[model samples]
Target: MLTNNIIFYSDESSIKISVNKDLFNKMYQYCDKSYPNETGGILIGTYLDKQTAEIVAVIGPSEDSKTWKTRFNRGAKGINKLLKEYWEQGIYYLGEWHFHPNGSPYPSNIDTDTLTSISNNSKYSCPEPILIIISGSHNCYNQKSYLYSSTGQKFEMNC
Candidate 1:
């Protein structure tokens, strides 16, 4: 588990991501609540610069979302409303986060495809999106962060 805020940089140094300890704990709690079933939510934060983002908040799984042992289909329920509220606080939608339960933090093919779709979707209004995948149990957890571009490029963020 993460005890402090961490910073990650892409291999190309094109982007930087910062995740705080509180947010990490919150994601852990959400993952714990779902247990064997996969669960996920949206990430909300602001850009510190053209290439840097600091994750400040996370919205957990929606009521309409579908969660299976190996797959999670995030629903759109209440997300627009939540995004509007967060926008008032200057917290824009940064990307998404999910738990893999006993699996690796690395993203699967579906994840990559979904992220690419999100990047191209104007409804999201984010040309590039970030993804955070958390895996493992309460005692020992792992996390991987990725950035996806509208051009179908994926960048893995490194510590």
Candidate 2:
């Protein structure tokens, strides 16, 4: 079933995230295909307000990336082109999504580091970036989403 916009809050920040049933199904399928290895991609969506974002699409991993049972390195290949195309269509780069094979859907140290880098990097342009972690076996999957603000605060959102 499709989820309505869900609001999650931290002491310093809050955000709203939503995923349609179709998009969820597609992400699940992609995660399943990468079973026993980690996979990830960028999240495309629009901001509803200063603190809220609506996730409309989840792009799959780049073909140049490396995936292993414990790690996933998202390569920078064709992403700029895709981002340009999406920007032309009025969709902005909201955040990222990744799967953790046989693990919990919580952010790891590396995940937090990556999010921090994204928030601090001038190239990203987004002051607050979302991170969605999908974890489970091939038969089932779960998600844990977080929002990281430029101030270095991270909030775990309900999914």
Candidate 3:
């Protein structure tokens, strides 16, 4: 069963990430499968307001993705097709989610750079993207989410 809602807040913004409990469990399962390696996926949802959004689905790592102990590079294979399908179902691309494997939930330099690049990319058309990082192994996982703006502002999500 899915929960009714999950709230993430900050001094500057508040977002209601709507994810079913089943989906949330599945996300953890993905991390369990990856274990010591890194794993990531896209977040599919819709914006409710300027400072609010809903997470409807999470796409797991692709077969072609590159995963390592300290890094994760999401593959492009079939992503477009998946996005299109989700779009048809009224779910838009909101941002990304990944696991840190054996690290903290804090975003690293590479993570920051990736968020900046995503915000700046004309193809994405998302000036602000949400990032969710799950740190630690399956036995003891810690999750943190953030919102990164194109102007280089980062806000930690408080749940």
Point out the higher-scoring one by TM-score: 1 or 2.
1
Global lDDT of model 1 = 0.90
Q: Tell me which of candidates 1 and 3 scores higher on lDDT.
A: 1
Best by lDDT: 1
| Candidates, ranked, TM-score | 1, 3, 2
Global lDDT of model 3: 0.83
State the weakest 10-residue window (summed lDDT) of model 1. 1-10
Q: Tell me the TM-score of model 2.
A: 0.89
Superposition-based RMSD of candidate 1 using all C-alpha atoms, in angstroms: 2.2
Candidate 2, residue 19: the lDDT equals 58
lDDT of 1 by residue, 19-45 (tens): 998888899999989988999999999
For model 2, state the Cα shift of residue 152 in Å: 3.0
TM-score of each: 0.94, 0.89, 0.91
Q: What is the per-residue lDDT of model 2 for residues 40-68, given as tens digits with 9 covering 90 to 100? A: 98888887677667778889998998999
Question: Could you tell me how far off, in angstroms, the CA of residue 85 lies in candidate 3 after the best superposition?
Answer: 1.7
